[model samples]
Target: MLSQLMVLFGFFALVLVSIFWINKAVRMFDKLIGDGQPAWVFFEFTALTLPAVIGSMLPIAAFAAAVYVVHRLSADSELAVVQATGYSPWRLARAVVVFGLIVALMMSILAHLLIPNSLSQLRMREDEVSRNVTAQLLTAGEFLHPAPGVTFYTREITPEGELRDVFLSDRRNPGSAVTYTSSRAYLVQDPAGTRLVMVAGLAQNMQQSGQKLFTTHFEDFSHDISSLVSRDAINLNKLAFAGTPELLRDPQAVAARTGAAPGAVMAELHGRFTAALMCLVAALVGFATLLVGAFSRFGVWRQVLVAFGLLVGLKLIESAVLAPVLVTAALWPLLYLPSLGGLALAVGILWLAQRPGVWRRIANAIWPWWRRARGAGA
Candidate 1:
């Protein structure tokens, strides 16, 4: 069980990492590269996001490992011998339960600690990159787009960081466009932000509807830097940027991070804890679901499918209740519904596994209905 769990975890990690990296690479590369940023910036931005990705993947990895190992053991009759040796269904599931708890603990650490820090770092890095004028602009002879619909180009950049023959276009406003051409310009850093100090510049404004042009020439001009990049909210607006304590403390304030209600952050806090619990829940779902029936040499693939189906159903339930829970803290109990359901299901399955007579009674009650349904389908 240990060996299989380790192997499956590594396997799942590689598969998930590759999928996430490939999906993120194109966008990250273009976002940095289109802005004419360097390769290292591309790598750094994508790398920082990986912890959140890995954190989300851990539960599924644990689930898959448990299912695969249990199904394999049943197919090999290893589980039957273990059961014959007086290990009850739940007792035989001890290794899997231990593995599940270990994974759950790891997930708790990540959800409560590491993922938020990584997300915070990613947010800060993105903000810094956007604010960086040297990286985004100041490249001589190349057109630079500091923001959407905004472009700047300089014919030459001196070693002293002076811009010569600058062309700047600002079209961030959908109704009108502004363009600037200067003989000389240099960026000035202030507490507010970076500003362009242009000498001997010509400004042209054109309205989008009328295409009316207005031109002005000045010996000196200072343009505010704020419009050159996207402005983020004063506070981090991502739930992933806050830990459980941050989320629980002043729930309303943290909920503002997601523009949600007072209970939103509380739901998030409870969700993180419940999400960790779900790792164990998912593992037990796999273990218990597979243990119910007699062994099949062909494998317990049918039971595995049933377990997966149950998990999917529980996830759907979780999704359906999340919105209400976020709005009403009284509904916070819904956050644990899936985990509790899984636990109940595991307990129920173990009971059935222990009592073959009861299982026989259940099969007798429903087996004919199943056949009828199958016949109707056929």
Candidate 2:
């Protein structure tokens, strides 16, 4: 049973990860390739995103695997045969518990180590790509809008790496517009910023208020083009990229480094721990839910639906508490409530499975009302 659970878990995990990863990759492909980025860059970005996709899907995969395995066993009467040999639901659930622990450990590794590192690297790469002005502006004979309200074009490029017949229109300021046309231009990088040194250029200025135009000819002029490229300041000290130990040992320091509230830091730290625990909860809940009733020839589709609904409820509870927990560090314990509730629910279902009379009594109480309602409707 344990082997079957592991095998199915792996299969389901692969399918779910591939589905999510491909969807995300497609979006990234369109954005990056549209920005003149190479295919390799797109693939690198998608690879870095894989860990997060897997982390998010792991619990769902674990739940599906458990449910499918249990349903198959029940359908084959293997569970009934085992029960006839005096095995209790709790005894049979030992394999599932072990499988859940294994999955939990996997989640812990991803949450604490792999995910943080990948996110950090991805951020760094994105910053580097955004700051690459040469890639954004080096193409000749085609107009480029490096930033909004700015148009740049170069007629030709010499083998000596000089831009010829360069034209630039800057309409970023509503009150004034500036246009620069140069016979020859060179791109220069300095400690201050990127500069386009245009030789024998004409600068044309127009004022919106006066509707007047002023033109000036210069022997050489330098235009700051650094702002033309999008270079958003990368926050290297993001809380999501920090190590768990660093977050735990000195939350105040981490908070300062990440520019986040103490409550947010605490929420992130505890959220990782609870994410792992959720895997265990999901697996156990899926297994225990189907074990509630005796084997039926019709299969356990009703129980499977109940298990899915319960999982969704747990997720909703998780989402509902996250905001409050983030608002108040003291409410960090609320992060565990969903997991605890799921465990209690699983235990309750197992207990009911052990006593057939309880389900029968509950069904008997509902059947009479159901029949009366049916007769009244008829």
TM-score against native, each model: 0.80, 0.86
Per-residue lDDT of 22 in model 2 = 93
Candidate 1 lDDT, 165-193, residue by residue in tens: 99999888989899999999988888888
Tens-place lDDT digits, model 2, residues 186-230: 999999889999999999999999899999999999999998876
Best by TM-score: 2
lDDT for each candidate structure = 0.83, 0.92
Native-referenced Cα lDDT, model 2: 0.92
lDDT for 376 in candidate 1 is 100
Report the Cα RMSD per candidate.
Answer: 4.5, 3.4
> Model 2: which residue pairs collide?
none
User: Compared to the true structure, candidate 2 yields what TM-score?
Assistant: 0.86
